[model samples]
Target: MAGSTDVAKVYERFISLVREVHWLNRISDLLSWDQQVMMPPKGVSARSEQYAVLSGLAHDRLAGNEMADLLAHLEAHSDELDEDQRVNVREVRRSHDRARKVPRELIQEIVTTEGLSQKHWLEAKQKDDFSIFAPWLEKMVALKRRVADAIGYEKTPYDPLLDEFEPHTTSEEVAGVLEGLKPALVELVRRIESSSIRPRREILERSFPIAKQEEFGAWIVRLMGFDFEAGRIDRSPHPFCSGANGDVRITTRYKEDYIPASLFGLMHETGHGLYDQGLDPKHEGTPRGFTVSLGVHESQSRLWENLVGRSMHFWRFAFPFLQAF
Candidate 1:
């Protein structure tokens, strides 16, 4: 058996390898981000190939026998670790186990298919044609089903996929929550429709230049505590936040005749950027350093965009700026 010092050394080695894998994953994310926001139209095929290669590399690193051994050792001696170290080990182990269950070829295929699907999706959306995207959507669904089966599940195939993002959640649990909320949501909508008060929708239709919108968005996000030095804002066809921690990037679209679209979209993406920027740097490249779940992440965006950004107090405070524009 290894001594305490020897065990610590092994753990540190394992952490180094994990960090390397995470760096590769981050690079892959950056490539996809560039493909979405900056890559030229002719670069789709090359981008898909690049994504597939990177996905395979990351999956191999995560699913290798070396990782399996390290995780087994860590699990056997988990009592020796600090709470945070134990949590990291557990999360890493979960990821490793899931990755090991899925073949590398399958992982690569999913990445390639997703890239192609996204391209077709954008084209279909632009053309307002569902048929053009139907085949890709069908392919993606079949691939996801295979992935779920490979990962294994107790109740439903969707359980594995839901767990992938939310960790320890199930489709049944989600359905239950949605079922409970349905009546309340319906009542709220009905009440709003029956209310005498009506918003002046045309107020937001006034001309707003893209440059001024960008400047205003920057100001709002800065106030919301998004670090411009550590992050950036760009324009994309659809608004999104990408990257993690020290290098977060967010994008929003602009419409010359629709002020609220860009303004609210920036606020939404900024919320996501703030969460990414706020993660502990020491925990970078680890599960603890990442957003907790997609649902939780969406909550942050909705909080900023709806709860705060749409509040009367916020607009009242910014009324001067709104008038200036």
Candidate 2:
């Protein structure tokens, strides 16, 4: 036998789970990219169906007893696992509970609306027109409010949406932070605008070919301790990173004149990559195997962007690398 019916077999089952779930996730990647760039202008209806199917697969996988059993097994050994595996098991269960609480129809509706909202938002933003987006956004907001109600919240509808981006954060808390931030940011901008000094205007705007930029981005990711054998990157209007734990995928938009567009984005996504890479593999496919929360995930992205990308240390180590071209 490859192993006994102990933790090793459970671990083997986890491997099967990882492969199965990641296939569903990859289907989503194809749908997302096609929706943004390749699908026919008239394909929205078919595309929605396609997305719904894939989302259903992912949702079912997470909510079904299969995932639950895996989680249960892992959790039973909770005390034996190290901190990371414990965290992974915890996350697996959290996702299981959160997703199961909502019905499948609701998940399909929300995903469809968000997809449409994104499409409308892009068209509206492109035309410098809010009117076109207003109706769709209002509908989206209403639907979202319904979602929040269905999900049940402590105080406000916005918490659920915020939870999508920043788990455990409430609407009031975000508003409070914004209320404080708006004034501080405004003052900072006012002072900076009044100052005689200015940041270099065209440093990022200088012409750089997309092919070359892509190459440069790949190089930088490698330097950041990114294990390319474990992951890859792609192109999208809005860059995002996704994939199964070890097989992380990142995406970015390429702009010929703006260096920041792809270069920095890949690094930001790399932070996400590192976090996934750091996850406890022994807990893979279980609650304790994934990110703690969206907030924790965002913190990883922000840390990579600001803490690492903007640091003197980063610049010192990588600027000459950039200055090469």
Candidate 3:
């Protein structure tokens, strides 16, 4: 990927910026999610202010003039980029464009709104009621619509939201892909419902202690080589991992009646923690230091869950812990 030491240096700076962005954005989103699902009611106003500051900082960082210079430098030598390098440049440009459009004030507003919406969403979900949170949801939708407008799109208004996760792919394209898979999914569900072989699920329904589950979750992340020195874990309704710099945070839920639920979910988030941990520290503030895109980020999570967590080797080490619980 390097054209010379000069190009490599440029990439180092790029990676550093990306690392900072990933850490900041991930941490911001995770905390907001936690405030909704776990945090105490008293913490809301304080958390909203904290989120606004973080939102402003990240927006200013990504949209700075230096990113423009670096991007132009890379663009000037487009012919020299290797295949992966080419993809990196293309992805960075796409991100830079979106970052450039939104004002920091608007970002701060969105961040504050996120905290407020999440706080209310928890209350609504707890009550099994939507109307209680409908106003917040509606505001969020309007904010997101403003975001989509700022980001600019050729087709639908939702394209910007979909673009956040996948590069160069649109809402319509995703719709088409999902449409094609629907029939196959329907048939698969039908066949599973009609199947004669019924494996006993009682093994998992036996008593599972919460403390033991927590210990097992901690033990599994360690086995996966996720650094406790730089990152940590906690409990949440739905598990996720995120952080700023080395201080990554991970969360998971416990199900006392089920054995596999929390264990695998913990490992699934740990997988994401490892990627953030593995990113080059030298590129700590640049976009390239972060993951190339969110699809690739999901791949990292899926790889750990499906490719590693499900593997014989991974299970060889992990199944014992679950069995103990």
Candidate 4:
């Protein structure tokens, strides 16, 4: 028997709670970025603890009774809310329902283990020793399987894991799509290998100084419309885009002998950065401002890297800059 005013108040309270959770996530993202980009090698253990504490706090805040009560009240009054409010309520409910199923300690442990695993992964990659990372990988797989079980799935255990990124999709659906595309993709690759026409691959194999590559890549990324005031690029072992709103950051790794590694990687990440910067700031801290899924998120990066960055028309304007570099 709640009136419109009560529902509005509950909606605002719900948003306030979710906003704090969102801020916690952003802080966690910053910590993770530091862990990957700037943390000293020995700092992994401490960073893992920090991640665990933060994960537990955020999970508790999201899954607490107040949040549950607010969601129930808001959901009951769904017809009274506007489209955007309803969307936010619905998205939060989905996340809350799933999160409530998993223990906060489990989430904390998973994040803590993840930080250690990342450190081990870097070591394994550098030393070319799988043994360094294999145990951690096994632990992570087991942890994630436990999470999938808690979330509940109809078919494969991977379905819940896939739903984490894709939402409303199943492994079977993804497998069927991939199965359909594999033949065509294989045929395309076969045709490319058999065709006699080939470009000079050695042109990209020239000695491109790392400093010059970074300079050139940043210039191109700026030209691609990533606002410098809002975003910047740096170096990481693997290229990625992180942060959002007024402070997006991207990273790329350079190889002195291979130009495309950093160049195209920066372009790919810049595409993601641009998308991050483009989200509506008014809806910040809410699902309405976020990208829908990983697939759609990746599409932006691939589109820029493959469709636009690789096009001859783009090369027509960009080749001069490259030659100058």
Best model per TM-score: 4
Task: Give stretches of model 4 more than 4 Å off.
Answer: none
Model 2 stretches astray by more than 4 angstroms: 1-30, 33-44, 57-101, 116-119, 125-132, 176-187
Could you give candidate 3's per-residue lDDT for residues 147-218 as a string of tens digits? 999987898889988878786789888899999999999999999999997879797687789899898778
| Per-residue lDDT of 198 in model 4 | 94
Best prediction by lDDT: 4
Name the lDDT value of residue 18 in candidate 2: 50
lDDT of 1: 0.88
TM-score of each: 0.96, 0.75, 0.79, 0.97
> Which wins on lDDT, candidate 3 or candidate 4?
4
The clash count for each model shown is 0, 11, 11, 0
Over the stretch 1-325, how does candidate 4's per-residue lDDT look in tens digits? 4599899999999998889888888888988889889999899999999998888888987888889999999989998899999999999888898899999989999999999899889989999999999999999999999999999988899998898899899999999999999999999999999999898889789999999999999999989999999988988999999998899989999999999999999999998998999999999999888778889889999999999988999999999989998
- How well does model 3 score by local distance difference test? 0.78
Q: Rank the candidates by TM-score, best first.
A: 4, 1, 3, 2
Q: Write the per-residue lDDT of candidate 1 for residues 87-136, one digit (tens) a residue.
A: 88888898998999999999899988887777888889889999999999
The CA lDDT of each predicted structure is 0.88, 0.76, 0.78, 0.91
lDDT tens digits by residue: candidate 2, 1-325: 3323475578557547654665676677657666765566678777777778877888897788887888888777665565755665565576677777778787788677766677778788779899989998888777777767877788777877677666667889878989988988999999999999988868779998889899888988888888888888888677887754667778888999998888889889988888888887766555556566777887888898889887879889887877685
**Would you list the clashing residue pairs of candidate 4?**
none
For candidate 2, which ten residues in a row score worst on lDDT? Answer: 1-10
